[model samples]
Target chain A: MILEGKKRLWAEYQKEIPDDNYFYVRSCIRQNFFPASEPTFLRILRDELKKDIFETPFHTTCSGIGYHSDIVPMETTMTVVARQFALMTEAGYENYAASCITSFGLYSEIIETWKHFPEVLAKVRKHLKQATGREFEIPQSLVHASDIVFKLRNEIAAKAKFKLVNKHTGKPLKVVEHIGCHYSKMFPSKGVGGAEYPYVLVGMIEVWGGEVVDYPERRHCCGYGFRHYLVKANRGYSVANTKKKFDSMEPYKPDMIITNCPGCPYFLDRWQYVIAEMEGKTYGGDGQGIPALTYEEVAGLVLGYNPWDLGLQVHQIAVEPLLDKIGIGYDPEAKYKGPNGEDLGKPEMPMSIRCC
Target chain B: MGKLYDMLVEDVRFQEGMKSCMNCGTCTAICPAAEFYRYDPRQVIDTVQTKDEEAIEDLLKSETIWYCGECMSCVTRCPRKNAVGLVIVALRSLSQKLGYFVESEKGRQQLALKRTIGAWILEHGYCVYPRKITVENHPEAGTIWKWEQDNLDLIHKRLGSNLDGEGNGGLRRIPQESLDELQRIFDVTGGSDFYNQIEEASKKKAEEMGLSLDEYVKFVYTTNNGLHGRDEE
Candidate 1:
């Protein structure tokens, strides 16, 4: 479990929780917009990289970012967390995991605080008891998507069929990985590796036969000045900070930057367009954002997974170069037939992880 | 104007944070490591508003307390002024003071970030090593080897110094004496001796735990990007 940040979690927690077995938590972001990612991982688990796992639907959005963003009230959030805990308890799934980094951090805070601060926990728990009429233990088990990937590296390699034939200017694909803070920061102990750097994403990139570009700013947050993305940093600061990220990686001449978390991908992927707009320079596809991908998307591609079926067509930024390199054709609408002449549309979002 | 004391969330200037926290759990939910690590700064803040000592004390020891990336999303949207971000740092201070933080392998990286790497920016006016001037005919600064050879002028001439009061006022741009004063206070409050113990413990723990120092080290060097500015500026 040396996914980078896991050591800190282990050293800090003294093995409060660890191991490859995890209760996979889904992200609402991925579920709603990037739905393919959920099935991408689930499919890998059941079909390609078989491992021990079960799904429970007793969880809700940690709502951490939204709360901190000042959109919801503390009491409302407490009720939601408590209600989710009740669901986890009722479903008999104590371990929790989320695809989104922010959610993971939020849940960790609630659990530890409640377990230690009897008064506060008691109050929130009491409120939940009164509101939801269910006793919730709060989840003791939790993990991130990268944690699962890091633990199952060999299996991913074994199943990967598509090779990256496309590269940056015809160079061996060099990848700079930006590990998100929210993912590893909260659990410190049970974290995939440790805060700052988690190796799971790096390991997956390495297994995919790409060089891992090391940069000092690899662990820096995307300068998520949420409210100020328009006011403070606006597009200018966003572009500048993004350039800082790119400058750190440019020395390595990485073909692309890769990430696993949905928010990270959203920022890195979309911000390229913002940066291009600021710099008045055209990205590869003329207004398209720079090159990047989530590990699930990459896994689908390198494993010879279908492009359209995995929803590559909906991306705001183009990854055509990657698709071409992997010997997968670029389908702008994903309406093209496969080599067998079978038309593939898109994968439907999973409502639940039923063991069919 | 509370005298920020103890690691419990209660001791913090809750008024500063309490004004904004709708307690949406967004800070917790958006947190990257929470789900896997069992850490939620939002909960810590909730406890802080109530000033739960035991819970704060136990939390100070948890790996979660030290893992904050300091992104400050918690502050930007906190309608109630609940800076769980501030509460987390307070937890770290309390964790350090109470001797709850031991030197695990990752703690060493944090130490390097704070003392070795961060100390430079604090003491000097920049993060990189100081540059040497190569004034022609004055062999002293002549032929400066690897002194940002390309941007030697950029390094020495244009880069503003706090000495000239034209600096960006970054942590690095501050005067050494000024930083030392802050460090002295940190020594008194944040506890330097405790920091050293945890720094020591981290090395031994890394060895005892058979941790891979290289890959993890790569992660450490790549990340330590000016943590001081995580909340402000």
Candidate 2:
């Protein structure tokens, strides 16, 4: 845990992410779990930052979930990813921005695999040609959507209506920035700040006035193992890994956990509730558990987007306390309203963990 | 080299993932699954390196190969530069192909994944869609998920999404033509065949255990092996 040693390592891992004009692909799970996250990212990129982030409806899942879960063959995964690249190429965009870390890691893996084995790449190209009659040139850059946000963090902070600070105490908010294991663990140079001490989320937190919590288990995975969580029988392993993380981070008393991966935030948030139900324990200050937020949600907060509009209400853990700490006001009544302002019924509360 | 070793080396992931194993225990030391389960990547790599068909067959049929979460954390810390996670991927693929996956509880769950996400990919072009995630299947998703599921159209609309709508947004309806291409890709690349193998193996296992296919799906979906989070080995 030498400070200078980690600093030197982080310096070497910086990536050259593009400035603008990107092709964005949505995550299968993130869009389902956190419906607003992808839209929030689009808004932040296209509207707030005024970047040219193009998206196409034809682009489909990378089959990464199936690939990592062992249901989809590697060749199938590669061809599907090639199809995505074809879509990107057809759309006339070169910078590939993926909303899911798994997809990012898979793309990195495929690119590296092709670099090592041209014959495999040729096979994938033939498969794509036979199936879709489409040819693709690999994009110049492959980046996670968070990398785009990290690249423009200072600009976002300049336009921010709020900072990641406890407005009442006038102190920086304590934040736990959890990097997805695939973000850099698979290919260290692909991520913004390498695998061990990824600085992508940390850059945003620091720019927006939050103190990053360097807990001991900081490098441990959030444990959204594709198979472990997808299968109900193996979910204990998923929750157990997350529990290990929560147990490690509990002593830090961080205000919230921020993550770049789709499953990380979902598992980190939902597993806290599951742990509370199973073990009667909570990690936050009171009966509440820590709010596990996506990096886009954290960016949305600092940009002064309404909490409900950011889909903060969709979380299993309550986020009202964190919003209150940041002095962001929201109407509790509108939390369950639909687009037409109709009353969408509120959810039944959990037993142990507090929910709004 | 043995027949099993020949098959293992055929996989590009195994080719790229397994460089050499000196058994320094770095991969095992950093493995999250190793900490929770009676699994060690170092030992698994060592066993595979031995190229012993019997031991490799034992690994394929046992629960050991299925325990990896595939976080690839081992790839980061391995001094040997070996991607043990990728080796696990290759092992699991071989296990499924040879019908040995159904012999273990965890590996047998591949059938559930095939029917759910694998089917969902060919059907909806998305692995996990909102409509399929119900409170009954995913109670951990909490009550808010129920509300969201109930008001899917409205919630997505409020969030500025184009759910099930045409052309460009979150949860947008993937065009039928694109789905046709995806289906063809799966057909040509043996993904459909791989899925069938899982179903066939699972069906035989279910029949041997005297349960219907639907009943087997329920059993695998809900049964926890209790192998994790235990105090004893």
Candidate 3:
């Protein structure tokens, strides 16, 4: 009966695909770190998958980072979310998809708050109307971009040119999926499989023929604790939190780490470099650190997108090793090419490599 | 009897974060911040549960309130379903609102945060824009960022982002209408008041220290309490 209940929950995890139209709100961190991921997602949706996605600069940041950092108050954050919804209402898109997991979670929280307290929603509506002279209707469906990919994973896998398997060993690549803390920790019902076992990224990994590696500390925060990361005095907490996860997951020997959150991919990937430089220790199978990529980037790779075009070069830990393991061919020489196909050349000195 | 404890307990955050505290150490045991700092969520909860006005006021002015990473790990682990994270949030709100935030080392960093992140939203529409992340402050961004800055237009164009351009896709320039609307929202929702509060408190602290507000903010941004140190370069 427990197994049957689990099967029923898994079946309910999938949501209706919002292919008619989606208003995509870009993430602040995703754009800053992996600048190409959003563009790649647009390509996959518009060109490859043929889905209509509306992206705009008019939709501002969700103010989540600042709110969580304690500078922006809850009222301010909710008001900002209301404004974003107004923009969506103006554009007539009912399905709201956010590129950042933080924003996604914030949106979910704001909506839940409104559901529980109609007065709060009415007040925000009043504030938004007073501020912008614009009103909004709540979106019919709200989801993170990863949720959209998870919904369409079967389609993505069916069209994929490559599988997530080791070329020599002919074995499925062991992939570790890290769900961002905000994704489900706060509101389990809003997530794919709820907080304890979020299947957002794992769904994608499974469909792509990769084995999911379950390690301890899998549910830990990405250490993007808003203030912990921002305040210089508190960054040790951030590093230590991430180090704990690496220590737990290193024993699993995963080929690559996949994440649903924008900050998670950046922090998980960047901290490997910081950890190695500070501790003289590396985590992956070959003594190199495990490469981390967002689910969107990983999906793009499985669909045979070029690495450089997907902004893989910007990563602190190189994705080249993962690519080599999967037998994806690309010229390493032309990694950092300009818009006109002119070579920008790689960094003369690599920041951190395996040095023990 | 609107004492500090009374004021705090009346807050919705405090109400939501606290239940019958069974004096369990589960919160601290699961806290990532507690592992690294002198912070103890259990103790924080215990302190508030005492309902001592003096202790509550001291908490508002101390480093302990600022130590929570707000990951909500404590919220998940507490058998009583207490969210010490939310209580810390309430404490912080009170700290900033009452100007008690200027009394501690970590508390003073609120000014730095307000200037960079809080102000950025009102001005640029994005929290951590590329242009705002200076090469000096964020060397961890590595050389690619520097190169990206140098060739901003070309790189963004390659990535298919309109960037500063006015229009449909990519990080196009935020239209003035949208920016104006954002400012109005901040003004209406007390966000502007919060910013003013941080500025006013920091300004008073700066005056007390015989330094300008600008100098004071720079000091807060650059210095730490000789613990949990970061790259000095």
lDDT values, one for every candidate:
0.51, 0.91, 0.82
Q: Candidate 2's residue-wise lDDT over B1-233, tens digit each?
A: 99999999999999999997899999988988888888888899999999999999999998899889999999999887999999999999999999999898888888889989999998999998888877888988876788888888998898878889998888999999999999999999999999989999999999999999999998988886576443544
Candidate 3 per-residue C-alpha lDDT over A219-251 given as tens digits, one digit per residue, 9 for 90 to 100: 878787887777665677778888999999887
Query: Across residues B47-105, which tens digit of lDDT does each residue of candidate 3 receive?
Result: 88888888888999998898888877777678897888889988999899999999998
- Recovered native contacts in candidate 3, as a fraction? 0.57
Across A1-356, the per-residue lDDT of candidate 2 in tens digits comes to: 89999778667688999999999999998888888999888888888888898988899999999999999999999999999999999999999999999999999999999999999999999999999999999999999999999999999999999999999999999999988899999899899878765899999999999999998889998888888888877777789889988899888899998999998999999889889888889999879999999999999999999999999988989999999999999999998899989998888888887885
Question: In terms of TM-score, which candidate is strongest?
Answer: 2
Every model's DockQ, to 2 decimals? 0.02, 0.85, 0.60
Candidate order by lDDT, decreasing, is 2, 3, 1
Q: What are the runs in model 3 whose C-alpha is more than 4 Å off?
A: A1-20, A285-287, A351-356, B9-11, B227-233
Worst 10 residues of 3 chain A by lDDT: A347-356
What TM-score would each prediction reach against the true structure? 0.55, 0.97, 0.94
Candidate 2 deviant stretches above 4 angstroms: A1-11, B227-233
- Return the TM-scores of chain A for each candidate in numbered order: 0.79, 0.97, 0.95
Model 1 agreement with the true structure over B49-83: per-residue lDDT tens digits: 55455655556556555545456445544545466
Interface RMSD of the predictions, in order shown?
Answer: 22.6, 0.9, 1.7
